[model samples]
Target chain A: MARIDLDHIRHSYLRNPVKDSDFALKEVHQSFDDGAAYALLGPSGCGKTSLLNIISGLLQPSRGRLLFDGEDVTALSPEQRNIAQVFQFPVIYDTMTVYDNSAFPLRNRGFSEVDVDRRVRETLEMIDLGDRANRKARGLTADQKQKISLGRGLVRSDVNAILFDEPLTVIDPHMKWVLRSQLKQLHKRFGYTMVYVTHDQTEALTFADTVVVMYEGEIVQIGTPSELFERPSHTFVGYFIGSPGMNLLPVELDGASARLGSRVIALPGAMKSAGAAKTELGIRPEYVRLGREGLPVAIRAVEDIGRHKIVRATLEGRELAAIVPEHGEIPAEPRVTFDPKGINIYADSWRQELVA
Target chain B: MERTRNNKARFLVLPVLLLVAFSAIIPLMTVVNYSVQDTFGNNVFFWAGLDWFDELLHSPRFWQALARNLVFSGIILAIEVPLGILIALNMPKAGWGVPACLVLMALPLLIPWNVVGMIWQVFGRVDIGLLGKTLSLLGIDYNYVQDPVDARITIIVMDVWHWTSLVVLLCYAGLVSIPDAYYRAAKIDGASRWSVFRYIQLPKMHRVLLIAVLLRFMDSFMIYTEPFVVTGGGPGNETTFLSIDLVKMAVGQFDLGPAAAMSLVYFLIVMLLSWVFYTVMTNYGRES
Candidate 1:
């Protein structure tokens, strides 16, 4: 295992990329420590796969250096770097048996037959394919084939890291959950540095110790699951992570508070310099308090989704959503209030910290 | 729930069945009818009871032609399959080179078979043709019309030039359909080039290679047009395949009984060989 570091990596598919928009992956500088689980989370075309490929040495960044355990490996191939990668689709040797498929890497590296057999049997048991060791890989189901692919990665004991690029996309829902838990267990048992790339929030939040949220080819926020939920550093992160995402309202900054249209709300800290064009107050829908004595809101619709209710309302000509309990009271005249601790002040699409 | 079995929709297949009967079954029945009978003249027929089959099976000329057919097919397959795969592997994977290579590879398959034969016939003339003149200038005795070995070589080269593109095209189609992930995984696994070909490429190309082999086999086995135009079964009948010999018996000598019997035997040989090839290959695919 190794601590992988990316030093200002950037990539562009075009020959002469002068504009910032020409790059597929903009400047990214991050470090993944040894024996930690990381998830690169983003929407489609947000450079998550590109970042994963760069880490695995399948692709070289056009502009930066990559270091593995403080050794420069930017020019090395995937084999020379000792990396393993699983693709979106299952890739196994269809003509080989399950044992041979898992033992391919070991045999290719010139291991002895006894060693290859022992390692392959252990991996097959780990993947729950011990009884299918003699079966041809072509006859297996999709999930079973993917497990063989995972087994191929696990059979090698000298790999620096194992990367997965949405490997469970083709699996059924139940199998996806099962394989995910198995992967987590494997990570814990082996302590191999792993990087998983996905667009699903649940998969990212549940699988990784650090969740890196990305938007428009840039890393917007990197934090734990709860940190991402409570204090998103960017409006895009707040909008992308949760179900009924954060409610962003335009505001004008005062001395130690912010004014939304005509009403004023207490701020966590005084704004140092609010000279930006767009200033807004960001709060999650779960923190929007509904009562009878706060700012008046024109309720548009309310939807009951089993455990909770989503209250869609209009405040100052802008739509906002609030999550209310199923048994919570909705008065004839509804009013809303912002929790003091839940309010986040943004100057220009970036979060400002409290100075107290 | 049980599906409704309707008998009214069964009549929709009558038109296709009649078309097959008129086009294929009638001519086949005529051959079978003539194979077991004799005719002297004026629509007079007599039941000969397999006399023609007994005569042709014992004939040395028929056995020699069948041997020639087998050797030709074996040599063609041995040379063309590997050569086509080599050319396909060297072709560019992407960019403008793909279309350029495809067009160049498809050029030979566009020409008619007899026309290809005529081109080679002139091309092997010692006095005027480029290939023959070059061989003559190199102090080599090269006369296809006079030497049996030269005649066979010329015919084999002509067939290869005319049909190897078909194999290349089929193999190229199979090669391109392999996803890039397989190559990436192989690279990560540190596989050698030979292992990559053995484990990944050859298995992927198995189905198309079967088609190419069966096609080249049938075409070379029933070879009539090109070699007839080029060699004309000359030099003591060294190049006379089964179809050429059957045609010589039916059209040149006007022996209907034996010719019909030879045609049926030739058709059966082709059908039996094709079945053996298909069964062996598909079973191999399933087992491994």
Candidate 2:
């Protein structure tokens, strides 16, 4: 295991990268602790895969220091970095048997036949593909082939880190869940430094110990799943991490209170400064209460999702989603209230710290 | 309504079947008829009852020509497949260069086969051709017209130049179809360049390679125009493949009975070999 550090990493395809927009990956400076399961979560083209590629030495950053275990490794190749990666689609040798596919890296590195067999067998058992060991990979289904790809990465124990780039996209929903659980178990058992990239919030939250939410070529926040859900550092994070996502309402700040349209809502603490340009109040759907009290809302639609009902309504002429329990009643005159602790104030799309 | 719809669908296949019958079945029937009979100059014919086939089977010329055809096809396949793959691998993956490279590759394939032979015939001459002059300047004696070895080498090289681009284009299509995720996966696995080529690129290119091999083999086996143009089946039959021999017997010599028999045998050989190639490759693909 190794603590991988990225110090001021930035990359651009063009020869002269002058401005922020020119870069595929904006400046990122962070460290992943040894044995930590980290996720680089973002929508497509948000530089998550680029960051992962940089770490794996498939790409070199234009300007940055990549340190592995406090030693400079920016110039190292992927082989030198010792990283295992499973792709979005399976990348197995179709002509080779499952056993050979899984044992490829060990054999390439000149491991003894006994050692190769032992490791390959253990990985096959771990992936529950032991019975198909002798079968050629070309005949396997997509999911099974992907498992072989995963097994190939996992068979080598000497690797410093394992990276997964949305490796379950092709898997069926039920199989995806099963594989996700299996991956989680394998991570627990092995304690290898793992970095997974995914656009799916559920996969990111479920797989990683620390979820690194990215937006537009930059890392917005890196925190535990609960921290991200409860206190998102950026409005994008708040909007991205939830199913219906968080509602950001334009607001005028006044010290410990903010006015949303015609109503004044009390803030938990004082705002340090009203920031430039865009100012809004962000809150998750779960934290927004809907009843016969508080600010008036014009209900547009109600979605009954079995366990909970999501009320889609217009608040001060802006659409907002609020979650209510299945048994909760809808009032004839519907109103909403934001939990003071759950409310977050954003200025210029950045979170503003609250002053006690 | 159901009966009418079924009748309409059955009618749809009639024209296609008729087209196949006219184009393929008719020629095949003619060849079969010729193979079984002998004809004199005044349009009078006699049933030979496989005598021509027996003669062809026992002839040393037939065996030698078949051997030459096999060797030529084998050589062409050996040179083309890997060379094509290498060129495709080295070409620019993206940008303005891609279309330019594609156009350059397609130029040779667009030229007529006889024209290609004429171009090489002129290009390989000792007096006016740049290649001959350059070879002479480099202190080498090279003459396709007078030397059998030189004729064979020139023909093989000419075929490679003309047809290898097709293989390259096919392999390039296969290469470009590979998603970026596969390369990323290979990098993460710390796969060496050779491993990546072996495990990912080669397996993904299996379907294209099979097509290339089949096309190159059939074309090389049936090659007659280019060698006939350059060497004229010449320098004492050293470069005379089966097609050249068959053409000489049928057209130059006008021995229709033996020629028809040879054509049938030749057609059977190509059909049997093609079927064998297709069956073996497809079955291997399935088993893998």
Candidate 3:
């Protein structure tokens, strides 16, 4: 395993890339430590795949240095970089047996016949495809073919990292879970540096040690899953990471007190003085207390999702969602209160760190 | 109700059946009548009863022409399929170059078959033609009009130049249909370029390759116009394929009974070979 570093990586398809808008990936400077599972997570067209391709050496950055184990590998091809990739769809040799498809790279590199067969068999067992070893790949189901594609990547042990570009999109949901668990376990056992790119939050959150949330060709935040959920560094992260994400209410701040519409709520510290302080308060739905006291709200709807109820309401012209226990009764007149410590203040879509 | 619906469907197909029978039955009956009977002008006929079929089957000319047809078709298919694939692989996948390349390839296919023959005939002559003149200037003796080897080379090269574009177009269509995600996956697998082509591109191109082989085989096997125009089955019948030999018997000799028998044999051979080609290819496709 090697520590992969991206230093000020920016790319543009045009020959003369002049400005920021011309770049597909804008100024991404980050390092993935050795043996760490990192996910580049974002919506489509947000440059997550571009960053992944850059790290894999499939694409060259217009300006940047890519370091693998402190050695500059920016100009290397994918072959020279020694990275493995699993694509979105299965790409197996249909005329060959599943064993040959999985053993192709090893055979191409002129490995001994015994070593190739041993590695191919081990990978087949890892993917639970041992029984289908001799079957022609053309006759297998789509999911089985995809497992062979995955095994082809995993069969090669001498690689800097294995990159996945939404490899589970074609898989059935049940198989997706099974394969994801298998991948996580395999990573644990092998400890290979893995970089996965996906637009699915659940997959990114479940798979990676560090989740890099991206928006509009820029990396917005990089943190653990819990840190992203509780303290989203950007407004897009607050809106993207959770179902019925965080609520942001426009507020006026005056040192230890924040005014939301006509109601005043206490804060923990003095607000930073900046020109035109357009502050907003962010709070997760799980922390919002609904009771018979506090600010009155008009309940719009309630969704019962087996174990929990999501109460959708309007508080002083701002829509909010609050999660409560399914058995909890809604008061005749509902009032919501925010947890002071849980509330995050933002100015211009950036979080404002509080001084203790 | 279901029975009535089935009856209605059968009724709808009646006119098509009538049209097919009208086109096929009359000519087939004429050929059969000619094959079985002896005629001596003046619209007088006598029952010969399989005499012509037996004589035609025993003829050495018929067997030799059949052999020549098979060899020509084999050479054409072998050359065209691989060359087409190589050119198509090198073609640009997108942008203005794609349409430009497509138009250039389609130009040869659009030209009339007889015109292709005439063009090559004039283009390959020793006196005024560029190829023949260049060869003579280089002190090499190349006369397709007189030598069987030269005639065969000219015919094979002409066929390759004219019909290889079809295979390239078919293979290109197959290549363009593949999604980019598959390439991305191969890249991630750390697969070499050869593996990517062998595993991804070649397998995906199987259907088109089948079509290319079948089309080229049938067309090359039945070829008469181009070689007839260029070589005219000359240089001592070296390039007289089955079609040319049948036409010679039917039209040149005016021996209707033997010619009719030969035509039937020719038709059967083409149909049988085409059926074999189609069945084998589709069965292989299914098995895979």
Candidate 4:
């Protein structure tokens, strides 16, 4: 129930780190407002876990101040911070009964037995484990154990935030969907400031109100899911966030037009002084229109993914994917055209703002 | 679906069958045969039919030895299990200290049992041994040769020294296999140090601790070498455990019938107790 501010946080595992690449988390200066749901999304080894740990105080950053509701908590331990974290693997007390497992946090905090029992019963009911209150946690299934792990946090009434580190990795596919929606419902019900870390785009997009995309130890872009889909600030976000991710074609910019080999595509607005090398035009496969009247292209493969077809084609010696409807016609002399609104101009792998 | 009853694959077990027969079954059956008969030397044998078993059971000396064996095992377990867990808990979890600690802990287990006994035997002598001389100098009556209490204590200490490393090693194996996430989660739960050990660590160590307890129990109950070498069942037969007394009857007194009867009873006792321990511990470790 507090806004967490990770102020200029950077961490390196080495005792004495020298170079910038030595850091696991490069400067992370972000704030999660009170009661906001955020997902730190990135590939493996991208410092998503490091940032999450910094928020939870499990890891003390090598250089930065962490604040909870404007109070400096950088020096505080996780216990002192009163944060709850669910790890990738379920961490349950196997010797305890389901009731005691959920009641562990409150018991540790010296809550009265009656209070603990009442709170634990409520939590067990919430997690659908009410009947298993007296049963030992020994033989529960993976999803059930993970629910206990989640219930450990909800038993407490004073935790600042609940941090999840890929908590659904070991769960079955159907259980994953169930637990995910359960987490969303919990977030809405409790209004706890939750920060979820995952590499799955669907999990990130659906679970969090704000998705912070990271790449190579830095925050590449932080935006709403649709905003990220439409306007990717970094090329990594453009490539990493979508399923047949955004296609990047090397282009030369002239006035408001981008020339890929010989053909030119008009831009929505003129690029200002975005003088840079290695310029590419980024476009989503969903917006790339393939018809009989635009630039000539050789179609390589068409994948029917039930609802939509992904048309993989080579344009100007570069491969690109265009999404077509399931029953859409593929013209014999197929040519491709970019939807004017979907065109994003990048310089040095960073999107440039157009001078409107 | 019907399972094919192929008798051809049944013969494949013959080598193991012959190996067990030659190694264990023959000796065991011979002892059983001798227990049911009287031997008057020169291969002269007569049907005894449980007479030896009845006499051995009625003998106070045999009962005393069995009692001594149980007491020794109980003391060893009570002392070693906790002590081994303490040492393993204190051992360094990482860095060069880990290897150094492990090597030092494993040193005692590498020594042969009789060698360990011989070392402690000399080491506890009142006149020249370091421990006994030091105790005598400290105004203590510390002689294993004439004092039954001192002899019993010496053997117990020697066994602890020799085998507590085994318990430590097994418990250490159990402790390290636990993922770091458990500790982290416990910390976030605001668990006290004792709570962490009780809930997280002790439960995780259940499987290996089962092995350590069963091993230490069986080994201590069947203990013969170390005490035999150190105290030699002296001080008025006080330290004479079941195995030592059985060996004395068979090898020293040359009483084959009584020895074989005692051997069968001893083997069954060990087997029954080990089975009980295994079943109880495995059920306790049913979490995973």
Largest TM-score belongs to which candidate?
A: 4
- Please name the candidate that would achieve the greatest DockQ relative to the true structure: 1
CAPRI quality level assigned to candidate 2 from its DockQ score: medium
Model 3, A168: alpha-carbon shift in Å?
Answer: 0.7
Better of 1 and 3 by lDDT: 1
Which regions in candidate 4 have their CA more than 4 angstroms from the true location? B1-6, B285-288
Could you give candidate 2's per-residue lDDT for residues A1-356 as a string of tens digits?
78899999999988999988999999999999889899999999999999998998988999989999999999998877877888888887778899998988888778999999999999999989999999988888888988898897788887788888898999999989988988899889888899999999999999999999999999999999999998888999999999899899999888888888888988998778654688889989999999978989999999999999999999989999999999999999999988888899899888888887
Candidate 4 CAPRI level: medium
Ranking by TM-score: 4, 1, 2, 3
Off by over 4 Å in 2: B1-5, B132-141
**Candidate 1 C-alpha lDDT tens digits along B47-156:** 98899999999999999999999999999999999999989888999999999999999999999888998899989999999999999999999999999999999998
Q: Rank the candidates by lDDT, best first.
A: 4, 1, 2, 3
Comparison by TM-score, 3 against 4, better one: 4
Q: List the residue pairs that clash in candidate 1.
A: none
Fnat, model by model in order, equals: 0.82, 0.62, 0.59, 0.90
Superpose all Cα atoms of candidate 3 onto the true structure and report the RMSD in Å to 1 decimal. 2.6
Worst 10 residues of 4 chain B by lDDT: B279-288
Task: Write down the TM-score of every candidate.
Answer: 0.96, 0.93, 0.93, 0.97
Question: What is the per-residue lDDT of model 4 for residues B60-141, given as tens digits with 9 covering 90 to 100?
Answer: 9988998999999999999999999999999989999999999999999889889998999999999999999999999999
Worst 10 residues of 2 chain A by lDDT: A269-278
Instruction: Assess each prediction's global lDDT (C-alpha) against the native.
Output: 0.91, 0.89, 0.88, 0.92
